[model samples]
Target: MSGPIRLWVAVKHGVDVVLARADRSTGTVAMDRAPRKTSDFDRNAVEEAVRIREKLGGTVTALTVGPPTSKEALRDALALGADEAVLITDPARPDLDGRGVARALAAYARTHPGFDLWFFGEGSTDHFTGTIGPRVAAEIGAPSLSYARRVSVEDGAVLVEREYEHELEKVRAAFPAIITVGQEINQPRVPTFMSTLKASKKEIRSFGPSELGVQPSDWAPLARRDRVFVPEVNRKRQAVSGADPATTARGLVDALRREGVLP
Candidate 1:
């Protein structure tokens, strides 16, 4: 808050849920070969970080943990207005579970301290565990604000408006805190051609598990995902026909009531 706020936003190159195709025969999603993109909500996080920096004067560093391909997410962040990018990945052991990823992030934060704010999405697009932000905050002993719909920095403290099922909760924490934002926060900006080109040329700092003092065993998944399958849904295809509009409407209502679609 003094000189210039150092803000870090975490992004993930997760499966593009829209583009992902499920195998009809196996009734499972082909995660291994699924096309990937930056997690949708993380884009909102990056946008909010940039907006805050623009208003309060600060630098935004985007961080990601995954395989080499994860850099794609960083590039997207850079194009959106991040000043720097850091990628924590181990080519030898590319895959890590939620717990392992939290450890890697905590290790990086411990090594490179002094970040005033760390931002993240409420959850990833593919796997919405909603744990990484809180886990990292726990590891670093920082206040964690999850499901934030509105965030602002003032008087050396971060203020947040979190959404609940029944009400909106207001909270505040000093600098060096973590915030997980939901999609309701703000719409992410699309990168222009020039920005995208510049971002493509920007240098991204890379690191592995060892560099972060994370052991090989620690990188393994604590909870393994045995399989992922799309649930089979059966729909009743019925139509209501009548000669008049009122008759048709009444018939439709009657059918919906019979099917328990209306009460």
Candidate 2:
């Protein structure tokens, strides 16, 4: 709180799903050939970090563990208000699994103790696994705060609120903790043209696992995807016909009951 706090946030550069195709034969989606942009939810993460920096004196550094294109996501974060950015890339495995991504981030954490706060969206806009924050917490040996809807800094600690069923749960942890925030935490502000231009000059640092003294054997994927396929839909299109509206309504009700649509 005394000195400028270093804030690190994860940004996801994702492709537009409009071109998403499920290969029935391969049982996988064609991802490499799709258009990309900064994920919608990740913008909220950067927004929250910028908000914290605005209220409290600090600097925000955007972090992304992704392919080379992920720099677009980091630039988006910078324009929104991050002071700097870091890109962790592995050409061998461009699309890293959740645990692998967490390991890389944790390795970065080991080298960069200057980060007082690290932020992530509850889940990426594409894959909503909701596990990276906890995984990073385990890798870095820091406390994990998940599903945060409301957040604040108090006495050099992060105070968080999250939804639990019909109620809201509150929790807090000291600085240098990992927090995964839900989209409800804050509304993202649109960066002005001037701010966008200023962001272009901010430094975007790059790193690889080797630089952190991390060996390929050091990080293993916690999970892997076999394939992705769209399930076939079966629908019964039946019509209820009658001379009057009330009769048609009754007929529809009968048809629903007969089909077991209503119990």
Candidate 3:
């Protein structure tokens, strides 16, 4: 609290929902072929971390756990204004589930401590479980402030405003806290050409399971994904043909009523 704030933000390189396509034959998604990008909510978290650093005079370090390709997300974070980036990866296990991810992050903290604040998105874009932030907080024995719409530091403590469906809650906690932010907190800044170039030049420190003291059991996934597919939606191809507009409207109303879409 007395020294410069050490802000750490976690990001994910997840599948791009908009670009991912389902297989026509199997009806399952082709995850291997799908394009990947930084998670949307994580971008907001990075922006907020950068803003806080700019205001409070601190450093923002972006960290990620994924395959080697996850370095792309770190580069994006650096371009967005993070001071540095760290990537935790395992070539043997490219895909890590939520539990494994949390364990790896916790191990990082144990090896490299002295973090004042940690930020995470409410959830990843691909799998919106909203569990990573809380899990990490619990693992590190830090206070978790989830679903933060606004955050600030005052009197050596962190203040958070949590937004709910019909109500809002204000929470305060000491330093070394974890905050998961939503998109409503702030709009993420777009990286300019120069920033992108600079980010590309910055070296992203890489760590593997061995380096982080992660054992085989620790890296083992807690849950398995059976399959991913888009649900099929059938449409009624009924024709409401009529000579007059009034008749057509009446027919449409009748159809809606029969379908229980109208009361």
Candidate 4:
């Protein structure tokens, strides 16, 4: 492991989509204001990347695509252990779909050839499509390992243990590969006050689509979300009451029998 393994990690800024509460009529989250944090799954991938960089002796780069709010993700990555960070955003302020994101990342990969390994969470919390890793690999023409629980470098190759069917399987691939990690991979490290303070000074480079060799058409989403809505519960609610506990119990049993709950 004399030569460091250049690691690249893709991270997503955290927001609780469910907690925002969707309006079925509008197909949008009623998020007047929502607390945001880094997703646990993405954090796991970041942690693994740092650990691999430390063991194999390589620089770790955290990359993300979003608006100004996404800077938090880059800083968080730096605090957690990434040597550097990159933020890719749009000047016009538009949303990118999964395919668009993969394309942009692929263009980035082509522009930056130093990274020997790329890491991602099994799925993003906001969009659990689980398609980004494979899509990026396809775009970049690299080997990929999905659902990896553990990863290591050995004998000039990357070794990974991943879930296969009902059991785990061991697989190996040459360098310059992609890995999408599951939550079982490893626990992410919490940054201390010192680390947080130090991370503030780390370099955080910003890039636009042009800088990454990405075109508007290349980054345009394949599909757009038309709307969001919660499904109707379509059920009835009833209450059974009694003056005493014994009476309540009897009434409950009688009601269950009447409703054909008891066989």
Candidate 5:
């Protein structure tokens, strides 16, 4: 690009999946029971954006939509290399669906024009919906590439490779577009002690829907959680004991057949 590109990366804070709990009684996923952190895929997206800024000479802005507590994710992004962070939070926005999140992001993009690129993870690790990037792009009337496993920028055009069920799909699109990166893109760099210290002092901008001229009625219905429950595990096994090699071989074959490993 001729001018300095302003890159924006969208991230989300979710319950650490390792510690998340499903409240069967209330049929809701409870994040309060577990510690929270930035979504893993989003971290990769941030890393990719950072790399792009470093190579192309630009600024990286990390954006997130969530409750006030989501500032933690923003701070983490700052520690990772984002130049600035923005958090869109409001109580009325509770349970904001993919469309609502996209609308908010589109509003932000409209307010801050001239951004050469926008980046996002292929999908949040927790939800795995993988729809926000395209939805946001549609709302903003911008081009977008999703599930990009590899990416390159050259002479104002962006090239990307997306993973398909049985093949790799390639695409070339101009800048001022949105791209959602897959985990295969690159490993996220860990924050150094110095970076963390600096991030502590970095200012994070916060805003509400009203500031973006968004109305609650404009948002689509939030996704509902009818019920949440831990899955039950069942296992059956039988030991075949024998001293003769031939007998053991025959027994093993029978066991395999019984288990449907062989027909």
Candidate 6:
């Protein structure tokens, strides 16, 4: 293999299997909860990058921006066959939105040049904001394509296909472009026991805003959260007492009609 490509795969660690809360007072979504694995779409992105690297003979570097506890996602990436992992942790950036996170990642990418491609998921499962990859690419002045369902490289160029509401689109772009993979892009591979153990021992590079040459003043608020609150669970059950089956049936129909379940 010749002309080995350097691939950077972005992953995210979000709240564990719990419903996201929107702060009603501050409009900020609260993320201070137990950390979980990488986003499902992001796992596909990492797996796609790893597969590309395996075919093209290159290095796959997994990068994530989150709290210190986000290292778990990096370890999982390593277990999935990434060559290296980088975790960007900044206490001041605890509530970073897509734009802020993109700025940081763009700066990191600028510092480490010679990467042939940048890969990310279409969106994070928790936030569901499909903006980071495009934002990072714009900040770095690189061309980008999002929602890619299939991708292949040929003659130093990338061929990709994506779906629109009513159309299927195909794109061919040069190297050093950013691409966001959708769930349909590829199925993520499960890690073996040995791979898991090896990933646990892998060295993860950590950085902060200062290390990335980003000042607090340089950061701009792209999105704002007003408050965070758990949604109230409604589990009221109604019981109807009836003496006959016909009466019970009539009651049930009445209840369904009242709830607009039937006309």
- Please provide TM-scores, in order, for all candidate models, with all chains considered together: 0.92, 0.84, 0.91, 0.85, 0.87, 0.83
RMSD of each: 2.0, 3.2, 2.6, 3.2, 3.2, 3.8
CA-lDDT, candidates in order: 0.92, 0.83, 0.93, 0.82, 0.85, 0.84
User: How good is model 2 by TM-score?
Assistant: 0.84
lDDT, ranked from best to worst: 3, 1, 5, 6, 2, 4
Model 1 ranges with Cα > 4 A deviation = 239-251, 257-263
Q: lDDT tens digits, residues 8-49, model 2?
A: 898888766666777767656767766777878788889988
Candidate 5 positional error at 229, Å = 2.2
**Model 1 Cα RMSD, 1 decimal:** 2.0
TM-score of 6: 0.83
Give the candidate number with the greatest TM-score. Answer: 1
Clashes of each: 0, 0, 0, 3, 0, 16
User: Alpha-carbon error at 194 in model 5, in Å?
Assistant: 1.2
Q: For residues 1-263, could you state the per-residue lDDT of candidate 6 as single tens digits?
A: 13788888999986655555556666555566544667889889989999988887889999998787888889889999998999887787665677778887987987877778889999988778898999898899999999999999887789999999999999999988999999999999999999999999999998888888888655566677654556565866888657898898899899889989999
Report the lDDT of model 4 for residue 50: 94
Runs in model 4 lying further than 4 Å from the true structure: 24-27, 30-36, 234-263
lDDT of 4 at 133: 92
How many angstroms is residue 225 displaced in model 1 relative to the true structure, after the best TM-score fit? 0.5
Ranking by TM-score: 1, 3, 5, 4, 2, 6
Write down the TM-score for model 3: 0.91
Candidate 4 per-residue C-alpha lDDT over 37-69 given as tens digits, one digit per residue, 9 for 90 to 100: 566688888899999877767889999877768
lDDT of 1 by residue, 153-252 (tens): 9978999999899998999999989999999999999999999999999999998877887787876788867888888889776777899999999999
Candidate 4 achieves a global lDDT of 0.82
The model with the greater TM-score, 1 or 3, is: 1
